[model samples]
Target: MVREFKLPDVGEGLTEAEIVSWLVEPGDTVAEDQPVAEVETDKAVVEVPAPVNGTVKEILAEEGEMVPVGTVIITFDVEGEVPEPEAEAEPEAEPAEPDGKEAADGEPAEPKDVEATSGRVFAAPSARRLARELGVSIEAVDGSGPGGRVTEADVREAAETSAGEEATEEAAADADSGLKSATRKVTDDADEDEPSTDTDGAEAAGAASETVESADRERTLAAPSTRKLAEEKGVDLDAVPTEQTQDGEPFVTDDQVREYAEAQQQAQAADAEAVSGGAEAPAGGPDIEAGGEDERIPYRGIRKTIGKQMERSKYTAPHVTHHDDVDVTRLVETRGRLKEKAEARDTKLTYMPFVVKAIVAALKEYPVLNSQLDEDNEEIVLKGEYNIGVATATDAGLMVPVIKGADRKGMLDIADEMRDLIEKARDRSIAREEMQGGTFSITNFGAIGGEYATPIINYPETAILGLGAIKDRPRVVEREAQGASDGANGEAVSKEVVPRKVMTLSLSIDHRVIDGAEAAQFVNTVKEYLENPELLLLE
Candidate 1:
């Protein structure tokens, strides 16, 4: 009999999954529990196994197509019984409206034909689900079910039996567990006073307890951002105490977490030092050197996105970058005053807010810079509103969190949102949604000391601006003395480039979405604002 294998509920309330690939095809003989396909849900890639030992009759879903839970994915002919056509034919339907009565009331519908009995023993819904995972035919096992019913144990035993058959004499002969196999025997010596309900309850508790204990060794609990932070801080997963308890409450404070992380780094360094001293080497073993191999990890996350984007922009957008040094001596001094004024208002003023203001002003003059090429539709998408993406580097990878409706927000709001987004990115709290839908991107690599770099364009967006470190350098300046010929101020000052502060800017753009002329003009516009400083606050 050919049995239809509908997609089972793979827990986690998964609603749908995308078929990643198929391992078995029609006419291929597969054992019960052999993987037939891989499906990718939002969480992970899960293997879907055959439920019956049979030849695959058909595949119902194609690769990469999303299928809902309970959707049939494959069919198999386990026993090779072809029912007579008459037996398989659908029963005659009642007249429309079923003689004027709505369907599914007191009149019971005909039972759907069952190609295979659920071969499970001692079944709770969860146990039945687990049995399906173990690939054991519920029918083949002894039922310890409520009334001679099979349970998870029967399913597991069946799996182990099959697995044992594949091993060599030694390993198989020595009682062993097979691929999540375990045995549970329900004893008849139960206390007579124990309630009937308690019997099933005890079995479930045992199963759950075993599962939790085993999973503890393999998995650790923490928020995604917390994990990222731990990695960046070099905190070993095993050594870090769980901040959360079984009741799912956090007990550790952020300060305590940070301190613990720092301690771990110190301990690791001490261990390395001790090893180098030959104190920790195996007795009489050759001394192994510590830590010298260099590795080039491919830029991932935000960095990777930045790279692809810039490459596309440079090659496709016809990029022409115009460079001109700006004289921001007076602008720098003005910024100091603004900072003091902002401090009085309990708002911190950073150079970025000024740059953002400038960019906004320029966008009004040149909207073409904020457009994307819809190559498939052969059209350009000129965004009417601005949602800027700010490139942030976290320990795990780079992230570009967007500031939606950026053009509509005031400088203070923009600054606050930018601060919040970057912090979240660094902490790994930013979601995938927060990382997309930007008409433009700005990467401030200057904080890390680079003067200027040709930043890659953030795809879908025409360009990305890379800001470099601001440093001080000497320049010709007029020094005033009694209105006579004066020498330039040779000392360091905020406004004057007196060997104290200089900044660099790099802009990567998609050549296809933007022209070289347009890119240059945009950069020039930004430079003008940075140079003048005063223009950043136009009332």
Candidate 2:
């Protein structure tokens, strides 16, 4: 039976999705839970898995095409009929036809057949280029690679053996002339202690030796460029062995030839330097065009979803922003001291966990900032549970994954969850629900070297907090000291400016549900927790 697979909603309120690519084709076998297609939803890119193990029958959705949810995207054929088994049994009943012995050339001598290696052969792109340069037909080479794919070694072997056969025939046709020309040289090298062996035996031995050398020379396979390089460097291609081989013949590639040439140059340069008492000149870089101009990128996939989300957020929310600076000297000290302890518990303690905890606590103090506006009902709905969304910057765009029950988790647990969620978001594997149920959000532009940004509110959420880069700056503090009054009233007080760690904070809120006063108070609460990290322990 054939079953159709539909595209399901992978994200919250997702109506349609774009098919990024199809990984399976008709006649390809697939397993249950194996990914058959990659689809981009409104929030993230996700893989659609196969529901049953079967052969892919058809693909209905083309790559980059947007289709609505619940539409059939692919079809499969499960547990095909018994006709294949019957055919196999028929071949076994007729056992007299042995393919191996049917032809004297080891394989079927006939060219065209059902199982002929003449149509096409799978090969890497680089392998195909080498075969073309060597004038070898890749389709006719016997592939030893997995699934009968023709590799570069296969092509090189075909070229070498073909060249060898031609050389052997030429030597055979000119045997008499070659023997006469080498007569004097053979006599000079004959063993005098062996009584100057018979001229007939010497001629036969010499001919046999020449044939053997020619056959041995034919066993080495190399591409045309590599052959030329070996010749220019005065290196014998057959002397340089390679791990990659086809039919037990050593195949040389471009890299192997270059490596041999480089070694030779280095040795020669060293010898020259020793003799002349000076070093060789270094190589120069190539002269290429400066810029990568004329490049255009298609705006689709995750970028498309991010653009839509940004537009919706900007148009839907009337935003108000507030900025302030905080002294995080104490927070830095606390983290430095407790870092080893946090590592002992098998977790990394970062500023984000502290920020998340502070935001959750501030939401408790100012519940209005954490509430959502129900425009259809004309009511403000305050959520009791804290699911804080942490905005992370990724290669694609921004992603806000929520921390479920953030108010109930401790700093270490929150840090672990935030780390995992941030990684998943960057890798585009986070589940759709993980980005939902947020009452508030936070963006740390500080991590990317920004002092502050007017972060747009994550739609439906009332507020978002932006963190700036922390740096050392001068700060004024008040202290009481005896007889330290400034030349005025008799109040003994001292004020001095000293260097301290400082950070900038920005808060953007939905003006409909939150007022400027409420946003300020919420930020003040967060400042209190950050400046005095001890307050978090009490909470």
Candidate 3:
């Protein structure tokens, strides 16, 4: 009996998810409750477990394809008697469009006859969609997938070949047109005795058309990472010169893009210098050509989610940032004293743990900083719990894993749990629940070497704190000392400038919820706790 498994709503009410990877193949036997695939939702990457024990039959959805909820993503061959309803429906479903392959008229095609299997072309649903979009006939595309199945790459290659052919025909037509025009010009100018002008015009027309044909003839080949690098550097992979080829096609690499970008910058600088020196510029300006085509990256999953959240936060809230510097000499000393003790207990100590403790302590005193504004009810909802979201930067994007009951956890405990959560977030193995239920957020840009930054408040949370790199700076301090000239019964106070470790903090708050004075006082309280690390012990 064959059992179909539909994708479930993983949580957060996400409408769709992209299949990141498959853990089981078509022939592999899977146990019940075992993870069969990893799917990336808007919140996090989660594993989808098998619903029943069965042999893998077919994968209906391809990796990186965003599938809607309740879509049948896979089918399995289970060892059981088929249910009566399913048994009746199985025959009907088999003849239906299992892969949703459609005709060019935007309608489902008729089911192919089983007897005509010899001429049938096997392709993934996504490949079929691409074929329809590119106006390429799927039957003409050679299969490169397992068991001679036609794949997306095969369809794309077919489309490119067709385009090259069309370009060649167009170029030939252009050459013929130029030849005819040149002939006409020569006949008209026969009495003028200047045939060289017509010849030059013909050659120029041919050169221009040839350049366009060459640009359209072939597409650049590059890995996704190389393409991403090129996009970041604002370099056109098609314009980048490369000596490497893969499968007889031009291949662009990261190093090649970087070198070309450097050369472009140099050329631009030379042009600027020539202009400044009143020198005549080159006829065509800089030699860099525009990109042939734009690269499209699917805007889905975590990246899209982040963009939406940022847009909402920026537009919905009027943000105000308060910046201040705190003397963290005592905080540094305290962490140094506890570092060995923490490592002794198999936990690595970092300044973040102390900062978390301090933030919690401050939030306890100024509850407004740890709250959400209920816009629907027009009320202020101050949260009683301290769930601190530590904003972590991952390769996929920024992820915030919350530390529940942060007020209850000790510094070392926060350190241990934070380390585990960060590791999980970075590897994309974190659960969606682990990233939820936050009362406040913290982003430590200091780790990457920034002094101060105005971080956006994580929506619903009234405020977010940004931490900067700690450095040694001169500060004035007053100390009690004996009289310099004569011995006195009472000690005299003296002021001296000394080097102290300090860190800058930027606190951004929603102005609608938190007043400027309140935000400033809240930061002052946090600074007090950090400046005197012993104060956190009382909390």
Q: How badly does each model clash, as a count of residue pairs? A: 33, 0, 0
TM-score for predicted model 1 compared with the true structure: 0.47
- RMSD (Å) per prediction: 20.5, 18.0, 10.9
> Estimated TM-score per prediction?
0.47, 0.58, 0.68
- Tens-digit lDDT track for model 1 on 1-46? 7688988866356665667789987668999889999875432346
The TM-score that candidate 2 achieves is 0.58
Ten consecutive residues with minimal summed lDDT in candidate 2? 86-95
The candidate with the higher lDDT, 1 or 3, is 3
Candidate 3, 1-539: lDDT as tens digits: 77889999997687667789999887688999999999998877899999988887667666755566787778788856443332233211122255888656464554453121236576655567767776666766787555677665566666556655554466456544434433433243445544343334434444433332112323576644566777777776778766556446786656566656654544444344333443344578878868876666656588988998888998998999999999999999989999999999999999998889888988887899999999999999999999999999998899999999998998889999999999999999998889888999999999888998889889989999999999999999878776642245455777789999999999999999999999889889889999988988887
Pairs with steric clashes in candidate 3: none
TM-score-based ranking: 3, 2, 1
Number of residue pairs clashing in candidate 1, backbone atoms closer than 3 angstroms, sequence gap of 3 or more or interchain:
33
lDDT of 2 by residue, 194-271 (tens): 442233533434443443221135346554446656666666676554566643556666555545554444444334
